[model samples]
Target: DLTPRQVTLRDRTTIATIVPFSSRYGVPPTLLQYLSDTMNKEIEGGDTYPMMDTMTTDAFATYWFQNFGAIMLLGTYASASAVTEGNDWATQCLGSFYIKPNYTGRSSHISNAGFLVTDSARNRGVGRLMGEAYLAWAPLLGYTYSVFNLVYETNVASCRIWDALGFKKIGRVPGCGNLKSYPDRLVDAIIYGRELGGPLDEQAGEERFDKIRFYLKYGTYPHGADRAEKSRLRSAATHYRLREDDVLMLKGREVVAEVERQWGIAREVHERGHGGINRTTTTIAEKFHWVRIKETVSDVIRNCKECKDKEAAKTAVVVPAKRKLDGAAEEYLAGSEAAPSPALRGEQEQMVGAEQNDEQFHVPASPPQADKTLTPHQMDGEPYYTSLEYSGQTPNAFQTEPHGDLAPVHLHADAALSLDPQIMGPMRDDFTLGYPQLHDSTGQPQFAEEAFHIGGHEVGRGRKWEG
Candidate 1:
């Protein structure tokens, strides 16, 4: 809980008292509901908060007061002890804020806070009073640093208050905030950070893990850094330990590559049969730590020329199915001068139905949602190849599921190396690059380039696309 402080109203003479309540004991239900409604109203105004949908009172309470309750500013000038709420929270409160750990475990010392001032309290300086009090109370609550991860650039007042209070702009992301006010345009978001009880490093340490490495090497804080700088570094070292004097490990997993490993890890996971988005993201997340990782994986899949070629291959294969249907209809009608009897028609339709259900022509059934997430490597299964070329000498045509189409799925270049010598011989002799007709490994009957093997599977991005 925060100490009672006097916050002057817009008139300057009218002083309002601010008080805080702890979440562990819980705020009153009615008051929490009132605050929820006020915050929901602010969300709808489309100026401050970015959340498009309003939350229920219970959800709002859990979000705001779940970790740390809230510091509430009273509207009346009457001393905090002299006042009591006879009506509702709306009439009694001017503003409120909650402070909680922004990141869990090792980074728990760094706190994040959300602020709200009722519409009636605008221009009354209640916000600044809360900010000043926050600077004092956050450290008291055990936070060493405060990070405002998504302070919208459009929120000029909030930016000014943070700037005036000596918080540094640690980072910025472009066009990341899909704000309601700017529905047609995405807005940039600023990452603001400050030491709770002292000044912040203007550079934000230049590198995230550098100080940890330095401290681990020397058994002390960085040279020439002040008390605040040393304190920040000390806090960051909590989750990390030197496993091999050079390698950093968190718990059991190696903490690697702040930015260097994102693309390579995303690509490696992606190139394993070009799995779906969920598979690609989950595999990397389990082993690596980095910012903007999900976005990176999304970019890899979205821009992959090989995957795009596979998409176009789907369209190419469907045309042959239509031709097969026309050819089948002509063959069924030939030699029959008159309409066949219903019994005969029924027998012919049954035969066609049996042919449709044959494994070679049967369309592939969708795997369960759970199975879709496991990449071929994770499942320890082989990549099945889709039929693009006919194997006249062996049983390599569409056998898995064929409805005028569908084959054994697809084989990656790595998997192709395991094929029979006879099959491999023909594949090698005819292999050429530049978007050749080959199946996708995603179990979908489609064409793909770059992942195909011509003579045999070669390492590194599978038969590299020559410029």
Candidate 2:
């Protein structure tokens, strides 16, 4: 296929390619004979093309029509005069190639293409230029991918050009063929492929302009408008005829943010002054279609700490008033007193009460006893276990020990098991083991001595003498 546009290389050389038409170019038979002869010479060399053998002019033409539906004639011109002169026009005939769906039928997305540059055009960047043109045309022809099937490893120039053009080497078949230039030595064949998305790029550009087209037709922004206004906008859009000059192209949000950073924020700071909100607002309004341009500029400058610091530096420094600070501290204290902490009702009050009295105490006592000195025998019960019984019980309920000599069960007063002991002053209440039966059975109080002592004096004993 022939491209409608021409490509100019980095060296300022313009190149173009087309399929030879006898009626159009008026080329003499001699030029066609020379092009066919030069192509066969390159194929016979065997360093680049995989022809395996050379062909005569008629055989090559027949092979070209059978393999490729089209052929490309690449021409390089140094000046416009050479093109119009039509003699010694410096042209190359790219060989026919077969590229199609793979055998599996799943890789129909990619089209395989192969070609060799003419021997006269070798080392002149003609291959690279042709490859670039092929890639550009492949996408336009509805092909999403293209692959070079057999790039010999010995051909370093071709490989370098492909690599520079962003083609990835997807595969390598080691020692695939013998090269004539390398004296019967075999070289690996490399496969290079590239994804084509040129058409989709054009589609994306069209979609970007769609938003601007909508705004131009209706003369109103698309978003943040009410239903009544939208109805009126639809009527306006129906009658409106947009001119080319009315196309106000707006960018996406990300591009807008970048523009604000570079132009709006950075420029104002570099210009050595806070140019006021109105100036910044007008500067942005002239260029962009922000949803709320004034608010957006105000927010960007207001939140910028650097801008604030610069503005502050230009003004006089004022010392903080001592009385104001003192008044603020007093206000905070009064507010804290007004709403007491929840902890003051329960845990905090208990902690405060404990601190006020010198008497020793324990808190959150473990299960079975708040009284630390009480033993299992004194409670008249067996030891408590959280797990299953040794007799294979499921631990659903308590079971007494099957012993005949077990002591009678005793029920202690709830007050005796309280975790917190009441405290009044510098002394505690006389705490006693209130087991009357144990006292009567032993003929003496079991806890005759005090559990606590202070200042080397028995305090809060079975009987109390002082507070």
Candidate 3:
């Protein structure tokens, strides 16, 4: 049996008194020969440990002890009689493996390792002991996570050990394993993984923002003595030096986007109104700092269906355009046809009532006409237009036969027909009069002799206008 009578590190310091168990050099030659021979015998026909199919014992030992970043094992005490017979062995060996993250640049992580147990150590908890040790040491060795790539489906013992130790079965590969007992038959390979420190929360375990945070706190670069990186870090630190939480702040792209998406949704739905991009951006900036927050908010609002629907409803409310006349009768008649009809008065009333104020008009008794000139009178403290006196019969003197395509008759200013003051009541007082130089289908100045009120009142008709 093999036992540690004295333990010493490379420095010759006696660690046996401090360490609970004995530590030794890497897998010895005899142990490697034993493990290699056993793997070849037990795993050659089966699909387990396929990498060892042609590897020599020396090559196997070199690979594990030299190539691997770290090595661990399960040591069992043997009787003195067994050592005297020149026969002692390590129950199992577990080695740590690492690969470049994404097969690219450097990373502070590694993968779960595999182990080999001697036939005599089967069901003796030797595999479990090595696995537990691996879990404990992986984090200390700077591996935050570990993934078991191939656990044969038939290897129920190893699977159970992993599961009981908080490892989760994440996925499986079908027809990838060959059972030792059924070497001709293929089986599925299961993948298992677990975070040594438990699953990370949102933005947890992400170091993308760490550099910025460090610069914010120290007002200097964290690492990378390179001139370019140092310059960049210095620039970034200056930009954020005035910030209150610059040192502890997180400014990653995905991180900010996630926050904006959440807060934007809440503001849009919970706030007093449909607070759009402007409001959302402002609200988020008050709590968190990020550049281009407006752009992020705009993107969120663009995809929001409810806001789009509300905007569409607002755009659908339409007002009819005022009609204009021409010197030619046919052209004037055509335009008049497009004007809102008296037949639709009921529908117009219903719509106008819903949209306009109840105090729109305050029409009093109509006054008798006394003269041709217009006089303004105040109603509801606003000026209004009243009727003009007419002593003669309604004259048709201004009416002329339709002259085909005659040049538009531009009336002189003296012939201006004053519009009813009531027509201006609903509109703002500052509104510009659009009557001058009114064009017809011929695109020439138009002349008219009639005046109508918006309330269907014909205030002046058959009056001559020169302008």
- TM-scores of the candidates in the order shown: 0.41, 0.35, 0.32
RMSD each, Å: 22.0, 23.4, 20.8
Give candidate 3's error at residue 395 in angstroms.
78
The Cα error of candidate 3 at residue 48, in Å, is: 2.6
Q: In candidate 1, list every pair of residues with a backbone clash.
A: 360-402, 361-402, 361-403, 362-401, 362-402, 384-410, 385-409, 385-410, 386-409, 428-455
Q: Give per-residue lDDT, candidate 3, residue 321.
A: 40
Compared to the true structure, candidate 1 yields what TM-score? Answer: 0.41
lDDT tens string, model 2, 239-325?
Answer: 433556554343312223222333354346434555767887675556544333464455456545577678888774432222223
> Largest TM-score belongs to which candidate?
1
Tell me the lDDT of model 3 at 92. 38
Sorted on lDDT, highest at the top, how do the candidates line up? 1, 3, 2
Q: By summed lDDT, which 10 consecutive residues of candidate 1 come out lowest?
A: 370-379
Residue 72, candidate 3: Cα error in Å is: 7.6
TM-score of model 3 vs. true structure? 0.32
Clashing pairs for model 2 are none
* Highest lDDT model number: 1
Clashes of each: 10, 0, 9
lDDT of each residue in 17-120, candidate 1, tens digit only: 66666662445566677789899998888777778899998889878877665445554433334434465566567788888999999999999999998876
Q: What Cα-based lDDT does every candidate model obtain?
A: 0.60, 0.45, 0.45
